[model samples]
Target chain A: MINVLVGSTVLPGNLEAVLEIYRELVARTRNEPGCVSYELLQLREDPCDLMLLECWLSQEHLDAHTRTPHFVEAIAQLEMLETAAPALIYTKSV
Target chain B: MINVLVGSTVLPGNLEAVLEIYRELVARTRNEPGCVSYELLQLREDPCDLMLLECWLSQEHLDAHTRTPHFVEAIAQLEMLETAAPALIYTKSV
Candidate 1:
Protein backbone atom coordinates (compact mmCIF):
# COMPACT_ATOMS: atom_id res chain seq x y z
CA MET A 1 0.00 0.00 0.00
CA ILE A 2 1.01 3.59 -0.51
CA ASN A 3 0.64 5.97 2.41
CA VAL A 4 0.05 9.63 1.61
CA LEU A 5 0.24 12.49 4.05
CA VAL A 6 -0.70 16.04 3.10
CA GLY A 7 -0.67 19.12 5.29
CA SER A 8 -2.86 22.03 4.25
CA THR A 9 -3.43 25.32 5.97
CA VAL A 10 -6.58 27.33 5.46
CA LEU A 11 -6.69 31.09 5.08
CA PRO A 12 -7.48 33.01 8.23
CA GLY A 13 -11.18 32.75 9.19
CA ASN A 14 -11.93 30.17 6.49
CA LEU A 15 -11.35 26.98 8.43
CA GLU A 16 -15.01 26.01 8.59
CA ALA A 17 -15.61 26.69 4.93
CA VAL A 18 -12.57 24.71 3.87
CA LEU A 19 -13.44 21.82 6.16
CA GLU A 20 -16.93 21.62 4.73
CA ILE A 21 -15.50 21.26 1.26
CA TYR A 22 -13.19 18.56 2.56
CA ARG A 23 -16.04 16.72 4.21
CA GLU A 24 -17.62 16.30 0.80
CA LEU A 25 -14.32 15.54 -0.80
CA VAL A 26 -13.52 12.90 1.80
CA ALA A 27 -16.89 11.25 1.35
CA ARG A 28 -16.30 10.99 -2.38
CA THR A 29 -12.71 9.94 -2.06
CA ARG A 30 -13.44 7.07 0.29
CA ASN A 31 -15.63 5.47 -2.35
CA GLU A 32 -12.95 5.47 -5.01
CA PRO A 33 -11.55 2.17 -6.20
CA GLY A 34 -8.43 0.99 -4.40
CA CYS A 35 -8.85 3.49 -1.61
CA VAL A 36 -8.00 1.60 1.55
CA SER A 37 -8.51 4.40 4.02
CA TYR A 38 -9.03 8.17 3.92
CA GLU A 39 -9.26 10.54 6.84
CA LEU A 40 -9.27 14.29 7.51
CA LEU A 41 -7.57 15.52 10.66
CA GLN A 42 -7.50 18.98 12.19
CA LEU A 43 -4.70 20.24 14.37
CA ARG A 44 -5.80 20.87 17.93
CA GLU A 45 -3.26 23.60 18.61
CA ASP A 46 -3.55 25.15 15.18
CA PRO A 47 -7.09 24.76 14.00
CA CYS A 48 -6.23 26.25 10.64
CA ASP A 49 -3.92 23.40 9.86
CA LEU A 50 -5.46 20.21 8.46
CA MET A 51 -4.18 16.83 7.42
CA LEU A 52 -5.34 14.44 4.77
CA LEU A 53 -3.98 10.96 5.37
CA GLU A 54 -4.72 8.17 2.97
CA CYS A 55 -3.73 4.62 2.17
CA TRP A 56 -4.14 3.42 -1.39
CA LEU A 57 -3.63 0.05 -2.97
CA SER A 58 -1.11 1.43 -5.41
CA GLN A 59 0.22 4.56 -7.07
CA GLU A 60 -2.02 3.95 -10.06
CA HIS A 61 -5.01 3.92 -7.77
CA LEU A 62 -4.05 7.24 -6.24
CA ASP A 63 -3.38 8.78 -9.65
CA ALA A 64 -6.83 7.81 -10.78
CA HIS A 65 -8.42 9.45 -7.77
CA THR A 66 -6.53 12.69 -8.37
CA ARG A 67 -7.92 12.85 -11.89
CA THR A 68 -11.51 12.49 -10.79
CA PRO A 69 -13.97 15.35 -11.08
CA HIS A 70 -14.40 15.79 -7.34
CA PHE A 71 -10.68 16.01 -6.85
CA VAL A 72 -10.36 18.62 -9.60
CA GLU A 73 -13.18 20.69 -8.16
CA ALA A 74 -11.78 20.49 -4.64
CA ILE A 75 -8.38 21.67 -5.85
CA ALA A 76 -9.88 24.65 -7.65
CA GLN A 77 -11.85 25.66 -4.58
CA LEU A 78 -8.95 25.15 -2.22
CA GLU A 79 -6.66 27.38 -4.26
CA MET A 80 -8.61 30.39 -3.08
CA LEU A 81 -8.94 29.26 0.53
CA GLU A 82 -5.51 27.92 1.33
CA THR A 83 -2.92 30.12 3.00
CA ALA A 84 -0.11 28.30 1.22
CA ALA A 85 0.43 25.30 -1.00
CA PRO A 86 -0.07 21.98 0.77
CA ALA A 87 2.93 19.86 1.81
CA LEU A 88 2.67 16.27 0.64
CA ILE A 89 4.68 13.07 1.03
CA TYR A 90 4.09 9.62 -0.36
CA THR A 91 5.59 6.47 1.19
CA LYS A 92 5.26 2.93 0.02
CA SER A 93 4.72 0.32 2.75
CA VAL A 94 7.50 -2.22 3.11
CA MET B 1 -3.92 13.38 21.81
CA ILE B 2 -1.19 14.90 19.71
CA ASN B 3 -0.32 13.09 16.50
CA VAL B 4 3.28 13.23 15.42
CA LEU B 5 4.37 12.18 11.97
CA VAL B 6 8.06 12.10 11.19
CA GLY B 7 9.79 11.10 7.98
CA SER B 8 13.42 10.03 8.18
CA THR B 9 15.73 8.85 5.42
CA VAL B 10 18.56 6.43 6.19
CA LEU B 11 21.89 6.51 4.44
CA PRO B 12 22.30 3.98 1.63
CA GLY B 13 22.57 0.39 2.96
CA ASN B 14 21.80 1.39 6.55
CA LEU B 15 18.14 0.41 6.60
CA GLU B 16 18.63 -2.80 8.54
CA ALA B 17 20.88 -1.26 11.13
CA VAL B 18 18.52 1.67 11.69
CA LEU B 19 15.48 -0.58 11.93
CA GLU B 20 17.16 -2.65 14.61
CA ILE B 21 17.76 0.46 16.66
CA TYR B 22 14.15 1.47 16.09
CA ARG B 23 12.87 -1.94 17.09
CA GLU B 24 14.29 -1.40 20.54
CA LEU B 25 13.19 2.22 20.54
CA VAL B 26 9.64 1.38 19.60
CA ALA B 27 9.39 -1.23 22.31
CA ARG B 28 10.64 1.17 24.93
CA THR B 29 8.51 4.03 23.61
CA ARG B 30 5.32 2.02 23.76
CA ASN B 31 5.96 1.44 27.43
CA GLU B 32 6.37 5.10 28.25
CA PRO B 33 3.75 6.87 30.28
CA GLY B 34 1.12 8.75 28.24
CA CYS B 35 2.18 7.08 25.01
CA VAL B 36 -0.90 6.17 23.01
CA SER B 37 0.89 4.43 20.15
CA TYR B 38 4.35 4.29 18.60
CA GLU B 39 5.28 2.65 15.33
CA LEU B 40 8.12 2.46 12.86
CA LEU B 41 7.31 1.99 9.21
CA GLN B 42 9.61 1.49 6.21
CA LEU B 43 8.81 2.60 2.69
CA ARG B 44 8.42 -0.32 0.32
CA GLU B 45 9.43 1.63 -2.77
CA ASP B 46 12.21 3.53 -1.05
CA PRO B 47 13.58 1.13 1.51
CA CYS B 48 15.90 3.75 2.92
CA ASP B 49 13.03 5.97 3.94
CA LEU B 50 11.34 5.36 7.31
CA MET B 51 8.47 6.86 9.24
CA LEU B 52 7.83 7.18 12.94
CA LEU B 53 4.18 7.81 13.66
CA GLU B 54 3.16 8.33 17.24
CA CYS B 55 0.25 9.54 19.31
CA TRP B 56 0.81 10.89 22.77
CA LEU B 57 -1.51 12.09 25.52
CA SER B 58 -0.13 15.59 25.13
CA GLN B 59 2.83 17.57 23.93
CA GLU B 60 4.28 17.46 27.40
CA HIS B 61 4.16 13.70 27.34
CA LEU B 62 6.00 13.63 24.04
CA ASP B 63 8.59 16.06 25.29
CA ALA B 64 9.17 13.87 28.30
CA HIS B 65 9.74 10.86 26.08
CA THR B 66 12.28 12.77 24.00
CA ARG B 67 14.27 13.49 27.15
CA THR B 68 14.37 9.89 28.23
CA PRO B 69 17.53 7.81 28.13
CA HIS B 70 16.33 5.48 25.34
CA PHE B 71 15.35 8.35 23.08
CA VAL B 72 18.62 10.15 23.69
CA GLU B 73 20.59 7.04 22.93
CA ALA B 74 18.66 6.31 19.73
CA ILE B 75 19.19 9.84 18.47
CA ALA B 76 22.94 9.54 18.92
CA GLN B 77 23.02 6.34 16.87
CA LEU B 78 20.65 7.67 14.20
CA GLU B 79 22.76 10.77 13.55
CA MET B 80 25.37 8.64 11.85
CA LEU B 81 22.92 6.70 9.66
CA GLU B 82 20.46 9.37 8.59
CA THR B 83 21.04 11.00 5.22
CA ALA B 84 18.80 14.00 5.87
CA ALA B 85 17.15 15.72 8.75
CA PRO B 86 13.75 14.28 9.57
CA ALA B 87 10.57 16.07 8.59
CA LEU B 88 8.10 16.39 11.47
CA ILE B 89 4.56 17.66 11.90
CA TYR B 90 2.55 17.75 15.09
CA THR B 91 -1.20 17.81 14.74
CA LYS B 92 -3.92 18.14 17.33
CA SER B 93 -7.20 16.36 17.05
CA VAL B 94 -10.25 18.53 16.43
Candidate 2:
Protein backbone atom coordinates (compact mmCIF):
# COMPACT_ATOMS: atom_id res chain seq x y z
CA MET A 1 0.00 0.00 0.00
CA ILE A 2 1.09 3.56 -0.60
CA ASN A 3 0.11 5.81 2.29
CA VAL A 4 -0.08 9.56 2.03
CA LEU A 5 -0.28 11.34 5.37
CA VAL A 6 -0.95 15.05 5.66
CA GLY A 7 -1.26 17.25 8.73
CA SER A 8 -2.53 20.82 8.66
CA THR A 9 -2.92 23.33 11.45
CA VAL A 10 -5.94 25.51 10.84
CA LEU A 11 -7.04 28.75 12.41
CA PRO A 12 -8.95 27.72 15.51
CA GLY A 13 -12.30 28.70 14.05
CA ASN A 14 -11.78 27.30 10.55
CA LEU A 15 -11.61 23.62 11.43
CA GLU A 16 -15.25 22.94 10.64
CA ALA A 17 -14.92 24.37 7.15
CA VAL A 18 -11.68 22.57 6.56
CA LEU A 19 -13.19 19.23 7.58
CA GLU A 20 -16.23 19.74 5.44
CA ILE A 21 -13.84 19.96 2.52
CA TYR A 22 -12.11 16.75 3.57
CA ARG A 23 -15.42 14.94 3.86
CA GLU A 24 -15.92 15.58 0.16
CA LEU A 25 -12.39 14.51 -0.59
CA VAL A 26 -12.87 11.25 1.29
CA ALA A 27 -16.24 10.49 -0.21
CA ARG A 28 -14.87 10.76 -3.71
CA THR A 29 -11.62 9.03 -2.86
CA ARG A 30 -13.42 5.93 -1.63
CA ASN A 31 -14.89 5.39 -5.10
CA GLU A 32 -11.54 5.51 -6.85
CA PRO A 33 -10.22 2.18 -8.19
CA GLY A 34 -7.00 1.96 -6.16
CA CYS A 35 -8.00 3.62 -2.96
CA VAL A 36 -7.29 1.21 -0.14
CA SER A 37 -8.41 3.48 2.71
CA TYR A 38 -9.21 7.09 3.51
CA GLU A 39 -9.57 8.66 6.93
CA LEU A 40 -9.63 11.97 8.76
CA LEU A 41 -8.28 12.22 12.27
CA GLN A 42 -8.48 14.96 14.89
CA LEU A 43 -6.50 15.57 18.02
CA ARG A 44 -8.56 14.76 21.11
CA GLU A 45 -7.14 17.76 22.96
CA ASP A 46 -6.74 20.15 20.06
CA PRO A 47 -9.76 20.19 17.80
CA CYS A 48 -8.24 22.86 15.62
CA ASP A 49 -5.80 20.40 14.10
CA LEU A 50 -6.56 17.71 11.50
CA MET A 51 -4.69 14.81 9.95
CA LEU A 52 -5.71 13.37 6.59
CA LEU A 53 -4.67 9.94 5.46
CA GLU A 54 -5.19 8.17 2.17
CA CYS A 55 -3.92 4.70 1.42
CA TRP A 56 -3.78 3.56 -2.18
CA LEU A 57 -2.82 0.41 -3.96
CA SER A 58 -0.28 2.32 -6.02
CA GLN A 59 1.17 5.72 -6.73
CA GLU A 60 -0.87 5.98 -9.93
CA HIS A 61 -4.12 6.20 -7.98
CA LEU A 62 -2.67 8.81 -5.64
CA ASP A 63 -1.53 10.91 -8.55
CA ALA A 64 -4.95 10.64 -10.12
CA HIS A 65 -6.64 11.68 -6.91
CA THR A 66 -4.45 14.76 -6.75
CA ARG A 67 -5.52 15.79 -10.21
CA THR A 68 -9.23 15.72 -9.46
CA PRO A 69 -11.31 18.83 -9.14
CA HIS A 70 -11.89 18.28 -5.47
CA PHE A 71 -8.17 18.22 -4.83
CA VAL A 72 -7.63 21.28 -6.97
CA GLU A 73 -10.27 23.12 -5.01
CA ALA A 74 -8.88 21.80 -1.79
CA ILE A 75 -5.43 23.03 -2.67
CA ALA A 76 -6.89 26.40 -3.46
CA GLN A 77 -8.46 26.57 -0.04
CA LEU A 78 -5.08 26.11 1.59
CA GLU A 79 -4.44 29.82 1.17
CA MET A 80 -7.46 30.60 3.34
CA LEU A 81 -5.82 29.22 6.44
CA GLU A 82 -3.42 30.80 8.87
CA THR A 83 -1.25 27.77 8.18
CA ALA A 84 -1.75 25.18 5.48
CA ALA A 85 0.18 23.28 2.77
CA PRO A 86 0.18 20.28 5.01
CA ALA A 87 3.24 18.19 5.70
CA LEU A 88 2.86 15.32 3.20
CA ILE A 89 4.74 12.04 3.22
CA TYR A 90 4.39 8.91 1.14
CA THR A 91 5.05 5.59 2.90
CA LYS A 92 5.77 2.40 1.05
CA SER A 93 4.46 -0.68 2.75
CA VAL A 94 6.90 -3.31 3.82
CA MET B 1 8.36 26.29 14.01
CA ILE B 2 8.82 22.71 12.94
CA ASN B 3 6.31 19.91 12.51
CA VAL B 4 7.26 16.26 12.28
CA LEU B 5 4.54 13.88 11.18
CA VAL B 6 4.78 10.11 11.07
CA GLY B 7 2.24 7.43 10.26
CA SER B 8 2.53 3.67 10.51
CA THR B 9 0.34 0.71 9.75
CA VAL B 10 0.48 -1.65 12.69
CA LEU B 11 -0.23 -5.34 12.34
CA PRO B 12 -3.84 -5.70 13.39
CA GLY B 13 -2.79 -7.49 16.56
CA ASN B 14 0.09 -5.16 17.36
CA LEU B 15 -1.77 -1.86 17.59
CA GLU B 16 -1.95 -2.08 21.33
CA ALA B 17 1.77 -2.62 21.72
CA VAL B 18 2.50 0.32 19.43
CA LEU B 19 0.21 2.74 21.26
CA GLU B 20 1.34 1.71 24.71
CA ILE B 21 4.84 2.65 23.65
CA TYR B 22 3.65 5.96 22.23
CA ARG B 23 2.14 6.89 25.57
CA GLU B 24 5.63 7.01 27.04
CA LEU B 25 6.73 9.19 24.13
CA VAL B 26 3.90 11.67 24.56
CA ALA B 27 4.36 11.85 28.31
CA ARG B 28 8.00 12.71 27.99
CA THR B 29 7.45 15.03 25.06
CA ARG B 30 5.00 17.19 26.99
CA ASN B 31 7.62 17.88 29.61
CA GLU B 32 10.28 19.00 27.14
CA PRO B 33 10.83 22.75 27.20
CA GLY B 34 10.37 23.37 23.45
CA CYS B 35 7.73 20.77 22.78
CA VAL B 36 4.80 22.80 21.56
CA SER B 37 2.37 19.94 20.98
CA TYR B 38 2.29 16.20 20.52
CA GLU B 39 -0.62 14.01 19.53
CA LEU B 40 -1.27 10.44 18.43
CA LEU B 41 -4.28 10.06 16.18
CA GLN B 42 -5.92 6.86 14.95
CA LEU B 43 -7.93 6.47 11.81
CA ARG B 44 -11.63 6.14 12.58
CA GLU B 45 -12.10 3.73 9.68
CA ASP B 46 -8.83 1.84 10.06
CA PRO B 47 -7.91 1.72 13.70
CA CYS B 48 -4.72 -0.21 13.01
CA ASP B 49 -3.33 2.82 11.26
CA LEU B 50 -1.70 5.41 13.51
CA MET B 51 -0.47 8.94 12.82
CA LEU B 52 1.97 10.70 15.14
CA LEU B 53 2.09 14.48 15.05
CA GLU B 54 4.66 16.55 16.89
CA CYS B 55 5.00 20.32 16.70
CA TRP B 56 8.10 21.81 18.23
CA LEU B 57 9.20 25.37 18.77
CA SER B 58 12.12 24.81 16.39
CA GLN B 59 14.19 22.29 14.51
CA GLU B 60 16.68 22.55 17.38
CA HIS B 61 14.13 21.18 19.81
CA LEU B 62 13.23 18.36 17.45
CA ASP B 63 16.87 17.42 17.11
CA ALA B 64 17.23 17.48 20.90
CA HIS B 65 14.14 15.26 21.26
CA THR B 66 15.56 12.75 18.81
CA ARG B 67 18.77 12.54 20.83
CA THR B 68 16.85 11.58 23.97
CA PRO B 69 16.54 8.07 25.40
CA HIS B 70 12.79 7.83 24.76
CA PHE B 71 13.14 8.58 21.06
CA VAL B 72 15.93 6.04 20.81
CA GLU B 73 13.57 3.57 22.41
CA ALA B 74 10.87 4.57 19.96
CA ILE B 75 13.30 4.08 17.10
CA ALA B 76 14.03 0.61 18.37
CA GLN B 77 10.35 -0.21 18.58
CA LEU B 78 9.88 0.86 14.97
CA GLU B 79 11.99 -2.09 13.95
CA MET B 80 9.46 -4.34 15.66
CA LEU B 81 6.65 -3.19 13.42
CA GLU B 82 5.50 -5.19 10.41
CA THR B 83 5.94 -1.85 8.61
CA ALA B 84 8.32 0.74 10.02
CA ALA B 85 10.61 3.72 9.28
CA PRO B 86 7.71 5.99 8.70
CA ALA B 87 7.80 8.63 5.96
CA LEU B 88 9.14 11.71 7.80
CA ILE B 89 8.67 15.27 6.61
CA TYR B 90 9.62 18.54 8.24
CA THR B 91 7.08 21.26 7.51
CA LYS B 92 7.81 24.91 7.81
CA SER B 93 4.85 27.11 8.63
CA VAL B 94 4.10 29.33 5.65
Return the top candidate by DockQ.
Answer: 1
Tens digits of lDDT, candidate 2, A1-94:
5666666678877866777777787788789889987766664446566666567888788888889887788778765863655545454311
All DockQ scores? 0.33, 0.05
Instruction: Give the per-residue lDDT of model 1 (tens digit) for A15-59.
Output: 888888888898999999999978777766677877777789998
Model 2 misplaced regions, further than 4 Å: A1-94, B85-87, B92-94
Q: What would the per-residue lDDT of candidate 2 be over residues B1-94, giving only the tens digit for each residue?
A: 6556666679988877777888888888889979987877665567776777677888788889889998898879866864755545454311
Q: Using alpha carbons, what is the TM-score of model 2?
A: 0.51
- Please give the RMSD of candidate 2 to the true structure: 11.7
Best by the lDDT measure: 1
- In angstroms, give how far residue B29 of model 2 lies from its true place: 1.2
How accurate locally is residue B34 in candidate 2, as Cα lDDT from 0 to 100?
A: 95
Give the per-residue lDDT digits (tens) of candidate 1, residues B1-94. 7777777898768878888888899999999999997876666567777777778998899999999999999989988988544445456432
Query: What TM-score does chain B of candidate 2 reach?
Result: 0.87
